[model samples]
Target: MTSASPTRAPGPFSRFEWLVAGRYLRARRRDAFISVISALTMIGIALGVATLIVVMSVMNGFRDELLGKILGLNGHFTGFPIEEVFHDYEAVRDRLEGVDGVIAATAFVEGQALVTSQYASSGVNIRGMSIGDIEKLPLLYSSVLYGGWDDWDNLEGVAIGSRLAGQLGLGIGDPITIVTPNGPQTPFGSTPQIRSYPVNAIFDVGMVEFDSLFVYMPIRAAQVYFRLYEDRLRDGVAQPDLMASDEEIDAAYERVYTATAVEVFVADPDATARMQLPLEQATGRPMVFTDWKQRNQTFFSALQVERVVMFTILSMIVLVAAFNIISSLVMLVKDKSSDIAVLRTMGATRSSIMRIFCITGTAIGFIGTIAGFVLGVVLALNAEAIRAWVSNTLGIALFPPEVFLLSSLPSRVDPVEVSVVLVMALALSFLATLYPAWRAAQYDPVEALRYE
Candidate 1:
């Protein structure tokens, strides 16, 4: 049996240490300034943590909203003809759909056109899609503010964006003329096709760009208006007159068709690159394939860089609070020097003295961090509502749809990020206590009491 060392220290964080730590933290007339400093330190920490959480959550929300709107409307991947226009799109669509992980394939004819209403005119990109494929994009069909998908195909009319309709002073059933340079080639030059189609539906996607610059029409009408597919008599055959009989109109339906592009959707958009090879094999043609990430690389890259920068800048708040902790602990140690000496003379170990100050300082940080965490979560969860309330009271558009892509503010609180912040704050607080606690533990009882 080994003999116990006579100078063995008491168990760590003993009851005595906690009692002394509590006593020192309590407000006293002599230590009023120290208490004030400690209070300010805790407040600084709370404010810093709360601000970081709110900013990070808002940035995350912005990124997610933008990504979802862009990708939701434009699919995960798209391919266009490199050599020739996408011919036999039906068969190509089927083949592309057969690829592993491919969710759906939609063939679309997109062309730049100038849309004119009686009031105004705007340059718009017109996308033509079949009803079956149109329904696949829930972001479009589901957002129809007025009018709907009913009789959408039979009407041969068009769907215009809400903003476009508003700007042109047009409503549902109003005729909107479209002029495009993609018409038939004539002796003079490429003849511009000018035709008017009634607006049958209106959609508001809550995104300024999309809501203001897009028009949707049935696939057949788009093919006809854009001259993508046409039926005519053989060369040298007599062309039918404008008032051709119904029989002639029926016969004209027989013609070859082509599509400008095909958009593919996959199960997981983030892994879109993995589906490239399979899509190429399925197409078996020289096609230009582009994914969402590649198309928006610069935009999303900027967002990521901004997030990191914000985190670094806001972390300084917590750092400043940690510095305050050091200042406050040092002051507390000075004010309690005599008490520390008395405790030392009464059989209290140096470690106990150190722990007293450590506990006092750590307590402030722990409580502050918890308070900040709670405040952050509450604010993040209700960020949009708060924005609305403030904006209403101030009579300002906080997040205007035209300026910001999203109509309303958005926030998403990530648990992992919150956890990291708490740990970092606690670590800084603990570190700040070390030197002050060490100084308190080094008190000399004989020298300290000699002056008394």
Candidate 2:
């Protein structure tokens, strides 16, 4: 070994290369300008990543929150008759129960009417639903904060939305009148049907659209109001019995009351599309099936488009930071030309010289990405609190339910999306190092140290 030293092993880049790379990254007072530029580059990358994470997470949160409220109130799939009321709804509902992916199937009647209290009047959508169904639905059950479900089916009882109650100056036990557009046709003219019912319950679904514009009535009451009576009655006409048996009239009433639609809830809404054909086949009737996605396509599409546009615009921040990385590395190479030349003269290869600068630049990106990730996660986790603090301090309301349709700001982070951002930042920063690193490697040792 003394006579002839064993050949040294070779690697792509050795320990010596890493040491030099780390040393160059360390801030030195003599290179104050370069050091400051390097720090700014890192800060720039960090801020960019943080902004992207926060914005993307907020958008995701908004979509999920809106979908939950809408879907919780409106089932995943609904089957409505083409034009006629579904007179054979029981048979249809029974058939639907056999369909795959059907969680719960029930009959529902929907209609539009003008509702008035002593204080105000407004047009609202009235849905006729069974009290048993209401009890089974967690959204409806949990929302009934004021009254119990015992009196929901009493022909004189109704459930109104909290916002609707407030607007009409009505509360539990207050009398509210519903007037439907259709009524019994008389010889002179048609008159709208009016019925007064006490507000048995108040529900708040936390959605402005539903809260301000919907009310619920017993299915039997809705049938009478909408005039879904037996075919024995003449067109939009009601006949009182003079000598006919009450049992015959009651049997006729039972035969006619039917649902306008059948609402179907599924275990997984995303897979509801697969249930469409099966459900239609099971119904064996000409029916229209509308999924939640189809019903709210425009709104969801707009949200997705806005999210993409915001991401593209914000990614420019990271791109700008990448350019800063390029500038700093270029300056660093120029400042250390003599040192690189010295290493080259001492048997260091050109590739090793390139790797040194690459490591230095990537370190900045790596550390910056980690810092931004942590900061963003923390901020998103405490978004509501931060929103409240900012709102209180600024004397303003950031999310007024009446205006924005949501009670507060929402934020949700997807780990996959976060990982993508991290990888993107690192990739951009690594690419930024290439040109400067190659230039440093190509310098002539003699020229670099000619006048040193």
Candidate 3:
């Protein structure tokens, strides 16, 4: 009569496929001891990944912040004439602007002078720049805290940094005298002269060293105050007798006879060498050029080392969690020997047996790692909020400006870093599955069933 209905074949991963393997992992939860150990392992992986992300982001943020501050206060690159004064700075500037990666170029005179206030005095590096050109360097404009640089007219006025103003107890429109090394000559003899300049404005650059040690002045004022000019040497001759006043003569001689040096400010902060080449070649004098990175090598180097050390130390947590995975899987193998033997009798291949346990172990690691990554990124992204919350709730300051230079916590989560950490977590988890999977695969059906 009709053909017998073909028996339905069991699908891959049917009840029989998972039952033996599922029992091995479920048994862990049934035993309070195994359950605690497994939970701790997951916690360890989560904490490890979270800590690594947060710490790495913080370090990266600090590095970026520091670089910004440095580059802002100091131009990306500086070039100087090989000779004391660049006779053909216009030509040199033009040539530099034509260089590859060169953005803009400006010439400046850099010198050291004594800055004095009513109550205090400190030595500062005076930079002579054109107001129009200086404006191109946005850092200078943004850093102006108390007064505007526009006030630096052809008049004898100067812009001091915020730190310098505070240390000197000076403020906007304060009268601070700048005494630069000058020379005066008269019929009697020649002597050094000093000139005074009123503090016109103050800028807060947030960098202590630069803020405390730098002042900007109009090019002519600096040339006059420091007497850096060629008028004192008329017709290539040293004229000590051109004294209207002894003070005038000495200052003029100092300005004219002394060589003039030009400090070139470039647009591209990284092309220190490229910009320097033309200036040195054109001037026929030895000029030194330096970039922002080279200027702050020590600080950046320390930060880099700290980042590596912190990452290395924190990874131990992940390693310990991996050991937990190993221990859990090993125990599962021992407890599931009879089940593994039964599966073997049912025609489940050894490779299939291995796959089951491997999947189980990997699942544990994947869950913990994914959870940790999500939580870590969330925490990192909202670090500022977390800091604020902690401060308000606990009544404790997290990052004090006086101590940290920044008033708030900094964070910068990188996608690449997160991906690497996730992959590493999964790899460690997969590694933990090996020995146990192998042990389960080696089980002999006859021997396993003989005992039962």
Q: In terms of lDDT, which candidate is strongest?
A: 1
Question: What are the per-residue Cα lDDT tens digits for candidate 3 across 342-450?
Answer: 8788777888888788877877788789878988999888888998999999998887656666545778998998888888889999998888898889999898789
For each candidate, what TM-score against the reference? 0.91, 0.90, 0.78
Question: Model 3 segments beyond 4 Å from truth?
Answer: 1-29, 87-91, 113-123, 177-198, 233-286, 388-408, 445-452
Candidate 1, residue 195: the lDDT equals 94
Specify the poorest-scoring 10-residue window by lDDT in model 3. 254-263
Clashes of 3: 12
Q: Evaluate model 1: give its TM-score.
A: 0.91
After superposition, candidate 2 runs with Cα above 4 Å error: 1-12, 231-255
- Writing each residue's lDDT as its tens digit, candidate 1 over 79-192 gives 888877567788888899998898889999889999998899999999999889988899997999888889777778999888999999989889999998877788999988
Candidate 2: tens digits of C-alpha lDDT, residues 223-316: 7788776655544545657776886555444346778888788888999778888889999788999999899999999999999999899999
Clashing pairs in 2: none
**1 versus 3: better lDDT goes to:** 1
Q: Worst lDDT window (10 residues) for model 1?
A: 3-12
